[model samples]
Target: MKDHHPHKSLDDVHESVPIHGGKSKFKRVISFFGPAYLISVGYMDPGNWATDLAGGSQFGYALLWVLLMSNVMALLLQSLCTRLGIVRGKDLAQCNREIYPKRMNFVLYVLAELAIAACDLAEVLGMAIGLNLLFGIDILWGVLISFADTFLLLYLQRLGMRKLELFIVGLISLIGMCFLAEMFFAQPELEEVVTGFVPSLPNSAALYIAIGIIGATVMPHNLYLHSALVQTRKIDRDEHGIRKALKYNFFDSAIALNIAFFVNAAILILAASVFHKNGMHNVAELQDAYHLLGTTLGTEWAPKLFAIALILAGQSSTITGTLAGQIVMEGYLQLRISPLLRRMLTRLLAIVPAVIVIIVFGDEKVGQMLIFSQVLLSMQLAFAVIPLIHFVSDKEKMGAFVIGAKIKFFSWLIAVVIAFLNFQLVYEEVTDWLSEIDNVGLQACIVAGALGLFVLLIMTIVYPWILKRKPSRSDIHISFDDLEFKQASSFRTILLALDFSKSDEKVISQVLQYNPAISRLILIHIVESASVKYTGGQSDDYETRKDLARVEQYAKFLKEKGYDVLFELGYNNRIKAIRTMCGKYSADLLIVGSHGHNGLKDIVFGETVNKLRHAVKIPVLIAQ
Candidate 1:
């Protein structure tokens, strides 16, 4: 292992929430409440509403068993996520990066991102439709307006995780309240509602919607998000503490996900009672559902409540999408960017396709688009789910906390079931596409892409179980508290790289004071003048001569102190040049001055000392 701190998951809020395990039992349980509620919002987002509405309207509550089944699966998988985070101290993305090779991690990262984009597309469309239904805004403008939620996310993040959790829970409560009123107005038949949970598919179309409901309910991104979110609560690492956390997190997931299950069931029931009863079996479009709810239920508030709930669901889910995007990008790629940029990039990916669909196909197509996005999530589900199961079941990594035989069996069962449904859906859809396309080249291309993805999916399913080894524990020992001091070793030959600035005086002063036994000084400067950069030492321009004079002068000043000094001048990339000169002189240490610049300055004007340290093999000392 490398000698560096492991990157934290959801680093802004890692261990930010206090567990308060020493407090009253009720108080201790309350600390575990927020993460699951944040997670549950994803389960009941606009994606769920879209799937539920489509499933109920088309199949008339026949697919409600799918929702129930999906919620149960979500509970199990989310508990596994909690187990992974608490026991391993890493999120799912981080675990994948550590276990899988880089190229493989990249593929998983892309799939994770595609899942987020698909999830966000549902939110974008849901938000836009809510605005359009309530305020009569154009769909394109509403989607364009959805871009502003990036700022909302930024503001909420600044307020902290506890507050963000509060906001999400409030929105979820609002959605719950809205649905309760809808269920009352719709008055779904009790016997038929009971019958919906008997686990039967009415037709092939119902099977597709059933899969969408499963996709929306057991979302892939939530798996990654929950693991990282659970880490926000500060807890003891002892056995009793871990056991306590697992129990409370389980309760948290159950309570929150049950609420989500109710919300989904309510959407399906409302659509089934009002639309199916009225012989309006094709009420899959959200706009159609909104307009029909008022007249069909004979109440004006029905549509109003529906739109309000849709807006809340879309807004709340958008926040989690931002966090998941941050997790996968940072975890899989070890890349971090400003939250603002990340949010914009994610929303933009969803927005462009949404706006294009609305403009080309119009608002009538938005509902299908939403359903398609959920199905896309289903297709990507196996990639995340398989690796998560593999991780939790690994005894070497998880130790005593490894999931037992039952959980191991059921988790893999869930993965297989999801893969089976996705494969069936692909088979049907591909067959339809192939038959419709008359061009041989297009058909060949489609077949090739399908085969390639199938191969990748198979690789993802088997790689962790068969080939991966648990990463070796770090060998380097570190003592944080036990302190020891010894006489400082001095550098025998020091290389000082400088710019023609007054900071050079401070740099030389620091070197002389820090390393008194320095026997030789190699003063070097890299002239970056336009004329000499590409030409290197071959260009003898006036700017190069001026840099030469500055270097010689510095050498002369150092020599006066009775030290042997040699000056070298080079051009082009300063980092490479300094590295070459360091090796050329056999210097033990390289000293460079800080520009006191960071952030945008480092981006625009490169930070030489930072780059030079990594480019060279010797010790680098930065002078303040």
Candidate 2:
């Protein structure tokens, strides 16, 4: 038999820290709320406040029905987002890129970027408006001040997510207090407030505002944000904990939006009671109605309270919006754009237009832009929503956690209606623009623009459906058993391959627990795959010899620990050489680490461990 001392230095191979037994049930359950609560605040932005105020004021309590309905819908979708992260161990954007084709993935990326940009614009405007209301400063200067918020966000990241969570919770509480205070002071008649809660439509304009409330509250970017954030927690596979987490998510969402609902209702109630009855109708700007609070309520408390809440709402939502943009860009593009760069990109997009409008037309024009931006965001929601619903429902991707029948039906119904509503809104806006242009050439240009947008919209809706076709079995022919490995028995020799990646330590640690049963341990390093370009004329054989020396050093360390060991080096055709080593040594098992690449690379390359297992007879183990 070959001398076992050949593998003596194997001890130097990367080893993982042992996992202590699973976490307690209580700890796992409580950990779930951390992410859900942080991500939900994206819905409670100043833009949302404006919409709710607009909804309640113009139509009174009739639009409250939309808030109730949209929250229920958001709860269902957000729950799906959490489930996808927990079960797959990946965020929604990463999953979509893995399952979809390159061209389609590009389209999804552009649409998401546009939506986030639109949202960031809203935050910038809201912040500027809040500053204007609070300090009597120029809105342009307020927009410039908003740039410092990006650094503040980066600073918050250093304190860790927990600190950020507590901050948002406190801010949200302040918003609740401000609104509650305003509601008490305004003291609208109980009978009129009760009438507002009943479901009814005021007019076409009110209906559009109601749709905006739904769109702003249950945003598409937030679905991506929540899914990615949930992955930060280390949760066990305990089914009960997952269920508890889901329940907490629903409760967190309900409470956050309930605060939102009352604030929205209060805005409208204050507006309707103060402005509508006095014949000071059509309060386009928030400041327009601010003076009435002091005059009608016989106190200055209401205006100051409203301005403070608006500032809190703007700042709080901006933090989340910035974080969501980071998660989306990183997850989908796989590019690590620095936080400063991302912040600048979003801020510039928002501030330039905001500054131009304020400088050209003044602060009064900001509200109209706010309305346009919210509607633009509403139109973009389907882009994120459709991909999420489609990918989560696929069994091959999501496995046992695939969306249930009832959830699927309802999600698709909402997706269809949202797409239609966005389409109609886009159409009306374009035609209305064309109607304003009297010149024939400008009208012709508008017609072509509308046609192009319609085509783009149709393509976005149908693209996922087209990609859902199942691949033929022959296209991805490997069987599950081909990748499966059995635990080692005493008589066998095991070969372990190490790549020094993050996953490498995990595999090494798992293998060390085996009983000293294996007659031999081979620690092999193949230098053929290493890049030669940076090695400065070093021959392939030279590099292989050097790696072999390292392998021998590793084997020596293992031998001192009383385990039989050997080392080998190979320079060419890695898969072929690994197979040859297994056959020559009659190795009983092979272990490798994988990055868990899915889809095309998985199909074409057949995974290194899977390829070796098929080429030879030994069992193969893959550590992710």
Candidate 3:
């Protein structure tokens, strides 16, 4: 009963392959090696390349210590993450829903997905840039081309977990080999390379790059990934077996992360040797780095190798990013979506802005975006880190494996330091921009950025403390259908809202099916006003005529069907309009066409049905 809520992690694969080996410590350790390797790929993703390139090109390996230090922190945090999974058979997402109230868990999930999205943008940009280097394709088209990998990811997963791991390891090897070959040819200064491992900040310029490196290296989603991945081996739950698995898992995480450090370090060292040493200090962009590698090293293969490594980095990271999205959605929100759909959803989120940026602005901003994306990842670290520390530190949750005083102190210290560094990065990045943007057309950007960061800082502090009370078992409901059916007959006055989607016609038809004897329907549509007044000065002819005609069709249909219909329209804040209409009409029930968003999006954005349920006191019905 100690593991009362012991969920079957990766329920599909766990039953397919159970571990049986009891002897040979070496062989036992190797089986636990795959998850950390997967997690380590995130450490060397395209986001890291952006930061490492900037650091090495500008400062010539002065900030390598930051990479080393960040990896150390990652080791500690990842170890704690796996302990949660191994001890409780629960990943970080599961632990979160179990620990926090429903409201707070949803918030945490949003922040986690936001962090994933930020990383995805970096991946998309890097892939586009890599394509530009390899084939001279435009970045916009390159971004669109990256979408084709969605099919590749779906196909790979169907082949099973072992094949996927082999595929990733092969890609990781390709990246390492390409970089290893480049680093050898570039021949970085041995003395400077050794000294780079020493901790030093050089100047404020170096600090910015150093902070970027730290942010890039320690990803929030990797924490979630590590916890879930470790459970794939299906280790024995007995005391001796648990202890053995923990020991080997630690070894796996350490070795894999150290190799990740090598990949990150090699990228920096290659940049420092080939670009910075040759007076090309501004090789910050992926395109610039690719071209300069050939120019500086006098080898045609250099640029191609750089581009290949980048493509591998972006592709590998995107695949893992999709996996992380699944773990997060399933673990936090209990929504089991197909990996393909989730991948497409996340890819689209990353791609839409990327496509827009390439179109409106030039593709050069991809480099800037890559750096900024890592900063956003830094901002979200506290949300994942604090919770992992809290849950692992809790004696009740972790039992015999709960963090000790020394571990807890250091873990909290890491969390506080990361959060503080993120705040500083934002402050400096924004204020530095604000100082440069004293002009007319962009003053608003600086002001908005400053305000945004201020709010972010406050959220960083207050977010963890929310939902402090225990989750109430009584709050659980088996089916929304049951609750809605229990009170179906009580409806007398119904408020129905429509957005004029294809679903709206069906919504109207369905409500007419309800066919109440004495009940009335208040049919409403909101034009969603932007400013204080309508754009046409409230006396427009053609546009308002079209809107009126649209509403009349619904009203005429309802009236002809022998039911009373009251038509109304409002502007802005749809939630407030709906609530006001409900109260003013004394409506017993409110019905709206659900756009049917049921994944991370529905949870994050508080979809129409959900927000309505929370906003109004009346029973809300989602029309089929």
Candidate 4:
């Protein structure tokens, strides 16, 4: 993980290149390109390879449409992430910390880390299998070799961030070329290949693989990582700059990810063509794919190309995965640690579980475990996606940069679809596995575990909704610590509205007794635009100048007593201003001097004091 300390200032890391105008529009667009590529790598990681392979080999290109749908979702999500980073000047995790309370930040951090660890597990396991396939190395030894790549990442950090990015780009390119060569050797029928892009599930078994493909493609950690990555360049930090960055970042993500789409689609196409077509429908294992690609294609170079691509995919992904882990930890928790220590710790979190799975289940089951790991990722998707939706959709946080109605509709649609599908997949898979077990005690334990997971999944989806549920405005339930004190005031805070009537001075005099208990006060005066306007130094209207003078006199009198006052002037009528002030100030009590009105006259014209008393939940004191 590169040194991305979350609490650090914007100027702490790279000397960001300025994205000012005067360069050609194209050149400015090029400057914002690197962040999206960093994100695009996550889309094509070794985890994706597992699902694509499983989908293709068993389903025979039937899951290609899942890949395509997953990419479109990825593009929309990542583009929102890009805009979030540019507009808020904070990453998703940082925004989470800012918008949410500390408890939620903790929960989000844990889920995000789990997603990263799950992703890392895939990358680490993929590299091991790749090593076992390309060379004669054992899987356990390859898992050990995976840790040494962290040191390589550290070394690359010294060369500069751009160089590290270029290296990953090179790896991406290499992996693409290797697969393109495989496509050449296998020579899939184009007509049949294109049919995969039309949606179909020929087998129910393909459903798990479809879920894995979606989960692996649109990752949780990448959302947090990309929001931070786009801030790498020192953007103009204005309306025009944000517009330009959003435009170009979307382009960068689309272009880079379409390349990823090709790499992913190619893998499936190769699997469908090479293995599924040749009576090898169950070749879901990466090792099996490697072994069969050579014999099936009748070319010695084919399997070698496959193994090399797998190794590159694994190594490249782990680099970014580690970086994302670092970002998640630091951004959510405000944590800072040595990059070396943090990387090893994160890798261990992945390696220990993976090593346990391989040891307990053996090598043959690791392939199934890989696909399961991705499904685990899918389960946690709701937690990450919900908060991201809340953040980008809010007009308050995003300002003019908030997503439009159409984008909001589609983004939410994607979120809801992913969440619903993930929960459904988990439910079906857990119940199916439970039914297979015959031991009563173990079955009870498994059932208990599934119930626990079900509850957790429910909470992950429910928590954001819980946060969004607005606190209802209940009537003030005022009480004192002692019953004897009930006759005394319960008001520690007060809102006093001045109407500048004959009783205004009397109301001011009455507030002295409450001053002993009152710690804060808010004074509001409304100058209705229909009644008065700010008439330069003097007004043609006599009432306007008199009203301004009265407010100033009251303000000066209040200041002389060293009272803490928040004075506000509204351009509306007194009734509306006082009514709104109750909510704005969260007033414990409202005080205003009423114009003594008799029966029919009070009913015909509105009484501001009477109106406020009826409208607000707080007690209103009217001094005549």
Question: What are the TM-scores, per candidate, against the unseen true structure?
Answer: 0.80, 0.69, 0.73, 0.70
Off by over 4 Å in 3: 1-9, 14-17, 20-22, 432-469, 472-624
RMSD to true structure for each model, in Å: 5.4, 13.2, 10.2, 20.8
**Candidate 4: segments with Cα more than 4 A from true spot:** 1-15, 20-22, 432-624
Model 2 / residue 253 / CA error / Å? 2.7
Best by TM-score: 1
lDDT of 1 by residue, 236-309 (tens): 87878888889999999999999999999999999899998889888877888999999999999999999999
Candidate 2 lDDT over 1-624, as tens digits, reads 011111111011101111123477554344445555565566777677776666655766567677777767777788788777655655667666655666666766776777777777777877777788778877889888988887887787777766777788888789889878887887778887777667788678977776677777777788887776665554444665445555655665566556666666667677777666666556646676666677877888788888888788778878877777776666666666677888888778888888888899987788878877776777667777777887678786566568899999999998887777666666676677778888999888878855765676666556667756533221112556568788945646888776545776776675677666555778876665455434532345566666767777768866876678877775455677788788778888787787567679888755666566578776788777
lDDT of the structure predicted as candidate 3:
0.80
Question: Tens digits of per-residue lDDT for model 3 on 1-624?
Answer: 165253454555543435658687677677776788888889999888877888888889887888888989999999998888888777788777776667767877888998999988988888888888999998899899999998887888788776777788888999989988898789888898999988888888888787777777899999988888878886777888788778888998898889899999998898888788878887777777887888778899989999999999899888888888888888887777777789899999899988888788887687778877887787778778888887787776567888899999999889887877876776776677768876856878667755664565455445446746464222113544445534446467888888888879768876876665677988887665333144622434464456667888898988888888888775556788789888999998888988766889877855677677899998777876
What is the model-wide C-alpha lDDT for candidate 2? 0.69
| Every candidate's lDDT | 0.85, 0.69, 0.80, 0.77
Pairs that collide in candidate 1 are none
Selected candidate, larger TM-score, 1 vs 3: 1
A best-first ranking of the candidates according to their lDDT comes to 1, 3, 4, 2
